[model samples]
Target: MNFFSYLASYFDFDLKILPYCIGLSLDILILYPLLTYFKWHLLSRLGVTLKDKEVIFSSRKNNFNLAYFVNKYGDRNLRIADGLSRKLLHIFSGIWHLVFLNLVIQDTRIAWQAAFVKSLLIIALCSLSYSSNKVFGLAGIMYGATSRIRDGLDGRKNFFIAQLAFLNLYVLVFIEYIARKNISNEDNLIFFSFFIFLPLIIGDALGEIIGTIWGKQKIRVWGVGQINRKSVLGTVSVFLGSLLPLLLVVSLNNLPAEWWLLCLSVAATTSTIELIAPRSTDNFFIPVGNALVCLIFAVYVIHL
Candidate 1:
């Protein structure tokens, strides 16, 4: 049998879904390296040096080259570059989900298969990065891409844990979809997935980027990083960023008034989690929290 057939038989998944899995893998393999290269070049231009030894050792001990930048180019430049890199990755993630969503709307079964494969690949890569001591190869590339957000002393550990938590949410949703097989509520399933991802892609990302640039008032918070201050403006950005997209989706679908309440409630939950979640761990909490709140609201409140 061919590779797709083998995978289908071995994994007990539909062979038709292999194309989506391959496409997502190719996208990550190609785009991720390019984005990492671009980020490295941009930071180098900004005089943010990431020496091999420093990246592997000093960064592990300190705060992922932030101190070097602070000493050389000042905190403002570092923050700007950090924010710009974050925006680039977040935009990529947002685009990826947009494509993934089209497939879900077309065929939930196929989409879930693709998502399950993608999640496994991501978790494997992250696990590999966590085990390696050297800052080279795939681990290096990952570090290059996410070093800013993973700036804490325990950043890599935090990143791996958070990814496990984040991807587990997707896996759980996929399980729910498969178990129910309620074709009538397929559209509702699509909406549920959209609500879970929209805030994470838009609200969480923009909150950090805007906060880095314009946030003057620092509100101290708890987290795993050296920097624990969040901006008032950034918190506002999170709420608005989440709410606006939800509103658009509701309007376009002509969803019920209850969905409007759902939108507002979700936006509030997302921003609140972002505000209070421990540093990079928000990457874990935001989606899972949104999923829980959505489930509670759907089951008890609006009876979705």
Candidate 2:
């Protein structure tokens, strides 16, 4: 097929969801740059100096920003700020999904298509962060704002890896939607989507944030970053965080009695995954692992 025909064929999306998807994409495009610019000032109030801001914003390179933070504030403070920034972004992403569920579309097919478009936009922005070209100023702002220090000195590489984990998440949800024929009902699709994602959103973010602030008893674990330790408190946070929303889901949906077991299983499973999975990769593994446990319960135990 010709290029234009191929483009038309590839994007054969439901017309009902197109406006919402495009609206969300535009919202992100407009708001994110402003948010990042504000975040730099917030970080400055925390400890970042004027020179540090200059280094982060002006550079085409990725390695120097983390070093500047470390030199100014020390490692622990850097971790605190980075952890806060990352989880806030995580929470914002969860809000986007909620918006899709409540306001945009109910069908899994449209939800997946919306997710695919958003992911492409994110991946494209991430790719541009690597470019040395001067026109893509927003790319640099994103790198400076969201890049994690533990991922090493190359902030752009670290940021890109995190986005890939997010992409994996969307892909996993699509796969689950396809494999489970029982979720044909609109309500079931919505429930399934929320069930699979809420833990990753609430549990994982709370685990990291609370753990970073208050976690005293540290345990060693495997991950890509320089720091591979996890806190006992963080693990507990993961469990509780995962469990509460699940209980709410059960209460709201009036799922079968056996679903309580499923909720506990998923919470425990995700906490364990978060503990063991490599540092940044938990984003992918936690949801995938949660889905697997849920699938088993659905097929063999609960028969959802």
RMSD (Å) per prediction: 5.5, 4.8
What clash pairs does model 1 have? none
List candidate 2 segments past 4 Å from native.
Answer: 1-17, 56-68, 131-136, 169-189
Measured with C-alpha atoms, the lDDT of residue 79 in candidate 2 is 65
- lDDT for model 2 comes to 0.68
Residue-level lDDT of model 2, residues 1-304, one tens digit each, is: 3444533443577677777678657635644565465557666777777766555544336446455556767766666766676677677767676666555675555666777777777888767656542323766555655665544554456567766787674446544644455433333434555567788889988998888777863798865655567899999999999999989988988888887887889899889988888777877888788777766666677655
Query: Which segments of model 1 are wrong by more than 4 Å?
Result: 1-16, 49-66, 130-136, 149-152, 174-186, 300-304
lDDT of 1 by residue, 1-304 (tens): 4434433533567677777888766646766677667766776787655663345322375445555546667666656666676566766766685566465436655665676677688778877676454554677555555656335466566556555665554445543543243233434766777788789888887887888778873798876666667898899999998999999999999888899999999999999999988876776778777777777766666665
TM-score top scorer: 2
| Candidate 1 CA-lDDT value | 0.68
lDDT of 1 at 21: 82
